[model samples]
Target: MADASNFIWYELMTGDPAGAARFYGAVVGWTIADTGEQTAGGVDYRMIGRSDGGNAGGVLALNAEMIAGGARPIWIGYLHVADVDAAVEAIKADGGAVQMPAMDIPVGRIAMVTDPQGAPFYVMDPIPPEGGGESDVFSVTEAQRVRWNELATSDPEAAIAFYKKHFGWGQEGEMDMSPLGAYRFLQRGEVMIGAVMPLMEGYPVPVWNFYIGVDDIDRARDAVTANGGTITSEPMEIPGGEYAMNAIDPQGAPVGFVGPRK
Candidate 1:
């Protein structure tokens, strides 16, 4: 089992699972594998596995009903918890809203929820691995793994407080973005996982964005454009000599890719 409050799984709800599989497979070098899993509604779910053979994330094809109900393609991270039901109650008490109630599945219990600031994510208590504990799916320097998680919310202080109380997250460091104010890095234990900041003007809504690791930043950016995705910005150098870019996948879902320039 993954440590409680850690980000255990990531998932993408897409309108075109096959096309997404193809696009991501090219850009991120993941091997999209059908998990042979189906939801209660009979929709198929697939896994995004890394080249080194670890599980990365998942993809679920959106049905017409889901699309009709305003389900746009987006990626959501799943935070690990010990008890889904108890966590749901605690979140509601803390002013968060339940988008989907906790439910039992073959893998474990899960619920969709939004923070007090209305940034949405999932909380899950996944089934134990057959032999024992699960391996880490996140790495600071590994290609094809999740490298960072970011939140753009209406209230950065309140959002940080909420996460700190519920998920045991702490502020690792801070960066001043001047016009953008402060960008706060969030850490769970010793791992610096993500950051939180105020939502910028003109953004549609407060939400979390995750960055996937890549080996070559320029080639990954090229792969994204050639695979029908849009690179919203030029690759920029980060503090540690790595490059990162913001992009929208072919389905219009925003994602980031980070690595060194080749």
Candidate 2:
């Protein structure tokens, strides 16, 4: 219960759930935690999480209603923030839309928002920060959170404005990428929390993709498909010789795990 780095929880909203559970088990080294029911957004939800009996995150049975006006499937990240209300106010003042207003949950107040470019994500005051909802709060290990925060949007200028206003997350440095204005990395203080990049032509929607850390990429990729998951990208090397793969769970929710290179 130290940092947001562990990404303590994860959730999938998918079309084929049973298959997703099986796929994730293979791709991710996790076992089944629990499956339960809930009613929200006009559809029922199936809770999915880390097999380690931890709050890895959850999965929901997606329906036409859940998608925007019945749009395609999307995965949203929930980041733990220190203060929910202040965060919400900053997001609003910075031109971001609050899709779901702040509401108190068993853990603490949670709010759903679209960064200036419309990438959907939720911000919450975790139980530990709010007191005993999860584990006690401590600036513990700089645990490696597989799903680190990053946003992809058509309008990154506005996007940066939104986060800086809300969470005080501002640009760290920009790396020149020829045609694509430099790629911008963001920071929460000195910690690398997320990034912002221009949306590619024809690939329109602005969204956030979660990144998971693993020890092996090729093996993780095979495990994903073998376990019933679908691979969107094959094992590839990222900078520094690190390798990774991207895929969609059996439920069609985008997922990726990163590992050290050979």
Candidate 3:
């Protein structure tokens, strides 16, 4: 089992759940199924399944009330913690804010929170199903799984420190982006999970970007355009020799995909 501070789940909160589902299904090769279960506020939740029979993430249908409350389409990752309530308090004490109070669901207790720099994510104390092992929603080399988790923040140093303190993440190394800033890699024990970089110019606010893995970068890029999504950044080779690209889904949510050029 992955201890506290690991990303156990990923979720897409979108206004058009069906459309977003189709887009991701085609691009990332996921099989999203409606669970037919209504959440506390009557929200429709769908489960994302990878081709290998493992779970990928989930899709949340945002209601008009949630949108009226300033909710927008977004992809958010969930970090597992031992105690949700304690984590919320630690975050608040560190100048972070809670978007949703701690609440218990079928899975476990969860609370929506933002880092001090205002990037939002969730903290969950999950209750594993009978005999179920750890979650493999995040992977380094598997298609349809989240390959990387990047944080674009106004204060990289502070954000890095905050996550390190709460999640026990360590800054192993970094890549220099020159004028933009350094891209500091974050690791949990031996796993190089993600990185933290300066929030680039023109982006209105700080945010977390998760890159899902694909088999072919070009094919995925084409799928984005053919399915009504806009390519924000063309595929570019990264450190590990794989290519990565950014896109905005039809409903205005920013997303990323990484894979080989072929």
| Top model number, TM-score | 3
Better candidate number, 1 or 2, judged by lDDT: 1
lDDT of 2 by residue, 78-160 (tens): 76777778878877776678888998765567888877777887878776643345431111221123535556788888778
- Candidate 2 Cα misplacement greater than 4 A, ranges: 1-9, 37-53, 67-72, 82-86, 129-147, 201-203
lDDT tens readout by residue for model 1, 1-262: 2342788888888888878988999999998764437778698798888887789988988889988988888889999898999999999999999998998988899999999988889999899989978657777788899899999998999999899888888887899988989999998888788899878853579899889999899999989999999988779998899998989999978898999987
- Runs with alpha carbons beyond 4 Å of true place in candidate 1: 1-4, 34-36
- Model 2 TM-score is 0.78
Give the lowest summed-lDDT range of ten residues in model 1: 32-41
How many residue pairs collide in each prediction?
A: 1, 11, 0
**Please, what is the whole-model Cα lDDT of each candidate in the order they appear?**
0.87, 0.64, 0.91
TM-score of 1: 0.95
Give model 3's TM-score versus the native structure. Answer: 0.96
> Among these predicted structures, which one has the highest lDDT?
3
**Global Cα lDDT for candidate 1:** 0.87
Candidate 3, which segments miss by more than 4 Å at Cα?
A: 1-4, 34-36
Q: Between prediction 1 and prediction 2, which has the larger TM-score?
A: 1
> How would you encode candidate 3's per-residue C-alpha lDDT over 64-144 as one tens digit per residue?
899999999999999999989999999999999999999999899999999999999999999997898888999999889
Using lDDT, rank the candidates from best to worst. 3, 1, 2
